[model samples]
Target: MAPGEPAEPETAVVIATSGSTGAPKGVLLSARALTASAEATHARLGGPGQWLLATPAHYIGGLQVLVRSMLAGTTPVFLTGTGFRPDDFAAAAAQLTGGPRYTALVPTQLVRLLDDGGAGLAAARTFDAIVLGAAATTPALRERAAEAGVRIVPAYGMSETASGCVYDGVPLDGVHVDLADGRIRIAGAVLAHGYRLRPDLTADAFADGWFTTSDRGIRHDDGRIEVLGRADDMINTGGVKVSANAIERVLCAQPGVRDACVVGVADPEWGEAVVALVVPAGEPGDLRAAVRAELGPASTPKRIEFGAELPLRGPGKIDRAAVKTRLQPGSHG
Candidate 1:
């Protein structure tokens, strides 16, 4: 929005989602939803302090940084330099001269900082909380951050819910997370008004104050929610169901593997074969064996390809469609 030109009175922010799976969407967030999200976050984080905006301002996670800062009456620190540079992040960190410093980052950015082993690493450890979202944070990443003593809170939410409503598997204050037939649904003061001009999509997604998410999850007995993966991401092979995200996590946990993206490919016999693209593709046979041992034979990838890095869509989401095309028959992967 242009400076001094206020947003519609009913809408505080209209975040445009990339909507990689379909057409893009403009999520209209009311001042109430935005404020509730920011306030609930502070309550969960033991009260707000300073927040650094590391991701792009266009994305929901980054937009909330500004919202949270406004609600707290504090100036948020922005990352310096073009793109995300560890050195630049560290330099920005040095500028926050306050207590209980906080920031949000994607898993890729967090991985870079932990690997920096310099000022960036030192700077990251000082934050009271670091909200990690915008992609599935693998167990390996969590382990790395924990070993370094950095407080990492894995958040689960989207633009439809006004940002991260579930932090570390627990819903924020006044927010409710549930599962209907295995699909995750959220209802709270944090929900966006609806898509700016797409009522059909809005009606299908939101109802009775609940915003249904594409991702499927398990509500643990302890009142914690465990997102299994996207509902459609379950791969059916040889009559057995398997989670591609499961394989990805297991692959990333292996030695010499930096990242992993698994997808189902067409196979005459199995219908949809499990295929994986790994970063640094270390010992494909051994990696396959490890996966077989962890998740069983049917879950093993029919093929594995190595890459320097994974393609991204919005924030740090792996470009699934791009990965599928590259790994498809006859195309260069």
Candidate 2:
């Protein structure tokens, strides 16, 4: 499709998946589906007012901000830049002129804003609600943002769902969430029609009125869903299973660690070894002890590597594949 070209008939929007895990697929969403999602979000959010666009326009989260703004009969304030800075976000957020102000952001952007700690913190407090998505938000980050007077709604969904159908582990109106074989499955009016020009892929992902996600999750007794991690992200070491995300959460909460990415590397002894890439270059500080305390010795990372920063792909998600490649023996010169 050419730039600025209109979408195909009956298609409200065409969004490309981040392809962080695999090849990117073009998701075809209809007008009804998008409107349903927007309406449900507004109902849950106490009705939409003004939106601040801090994320890139190409991604689903950013695009939904625009869609909701249009539906609410309001103009969204755009933060113009290739990089996200606290000052820029503050300036843009100051432009919101009414009550019930809203915006969407990924977890990484929230961390950066918290780190800035001046005008950025003040600006973040102005939003009535900020939808955090595209990646999981660490519990430590959430606590910090709350202490700063930020109302964060951690969202979960993909491009295939038109946007977020679940907010803070609760399914929005008209959305149904279930666990099938430990994988999160969604069925609702917000689902996309199918992937554009990829019938086989669509057939595999969506069936029986439920869209099967690659993420593994468990529904709590209180009716809240807890997403564990991607099913494919599980590591097997000495025949024991470990969740990369589970280890990462513990590492990120520790002192002196800015961020962390965990991956499984080939090891002749263990079959696969759990490895960690930590950011900001500091002493790891008993990470093995920490992991063993929480998840036992089998799940502890075998090696810890320090780096200035973890490589990110789209929308601030840690690029695990890139990190694994860089950690290989002969990959570094």
Candidate 3:
């Protein structure tokens, strides 16, 4: 089926995972599941309103914007182009004429918009709320957006959940969140039917009514979930277990650094060495010191590489597996 095409019979939509860490899987979502997710999102955001499609339509984040608009009986304004620009986003925001306006974006796009100065700040302030997802967002970035008057809601979910079932660490109405063995599990009306043509994978991911995620997280006393990095994405260097997401967060807090991705590379002595890839080539500038201050010396990256931009899969998510491949021994960009 082509992009944005409705799924067959009971299936409402089919979305493919970005496969940043492994093989991509096609998640099958039913009409009931999609509607449940969209409705819950609208209700959470103070009822339905016009939506701006700023991300790619093929991805769940962007596709949900269109789905929400359809359910709201509103036409979503699409930001057309191969690239996302502050000017384009400003124009799209200007086109919204009805009730409370909203849009979905990844952290990278949010960073770009925040960097665009007056035009970006003005456009960002127009949204009733912005759903930021696809990956973990740093607290530093969130603070910057908030300071600039952008109300960003950090969302967490995957294709199997039909989109973001958790907003700002809280499960949406009708969505149940639990942690088992340090892994995150979700169950709700928004749960997808299963993976398309992959029964084995489906059974492995979803069982006993809960879709098990690859992420590790902690449940707060206040009934909120704080997601750590992926379980598989954890780095073991010199017998020390370190969270790659934590290191990336520290690096992102530094000035001149737009984004950062941390991964464990093969190392004989240390078992696996922690490495960092930063965007826009910031001066390394005490990254080790910062990480040491936040975590410890063991969590510091063994090496830091700079690039014009980090590799992305779709919808502005950092492709860590691709970055690892490019940074492998004897490999070239």
Q: Whole-model lDDT for model 1 versus the true structure?
A: 0.87
| Global lDDT of each candidate | 0.87, 0.87, 0.86
- Candidate 2: regions farther than 4 A off: 1-9, 280-284
| Per-residue lDDT of model 3, residues 1-333, tens digit only | 345654545876788888887878788988899899999999999999999998887888888998899999999998876688888888888899987899999988898888887686689898999999997778878888889989999999988898899999999999999999999999989998788777788899889889999999999999899998788877889998899888888898887777889988888899998998888434657777889888998899888888888888866778888899877656677
RMSD, one per candidate, in order? 2.6, 2.0, 2.4
How many backbone overlaps does candidate 1 show?
Answer: 0
TM-score on alpha carbons, each prediction: 0.94, 0.95, 0.94
lDDT (C-alpha) at residue 154 in model 3: 94
Q: Which of the two, 2 or 3, has more TM-score?
A: 2
Q: Which 10-residue span in candidate 1 carries the lowest summed lDDT?
A: 1-10
1-333 per-residue lDDT for model 2 (tens digits) = 233765556887788888887887889889888888989999999997899989887888888888899899999999986698899998998888976899999888898888889898789988889999998887877888889889999999988898889999999999999998999999999998788777798899999889999999999999999898999999899999898989998888887777888998898899889988888425557887898899889889998888877787777677878988877555561
Pairs that collide, model 1? none
User: TM-score: which candidate is best?
Assistant: 2
What TM-score should be assigned to candidate 3?
Answer: 0.94
lDDT: which is higher, 1 or 3?
Answer: 1
| lDDT (Cα, tens digit) per residue for candidate 1, span 1-333 | 233655545887789886655567888899899889999999999897889999998999999999999888889998979878889989999999776799999998998898787888888998999999988778878999999988999999999888899999899999998889999999999998787767798899999989999998998889999898888788899889999988988888898888999998887899888999898635544789999999999999999989888988898888888888888867775
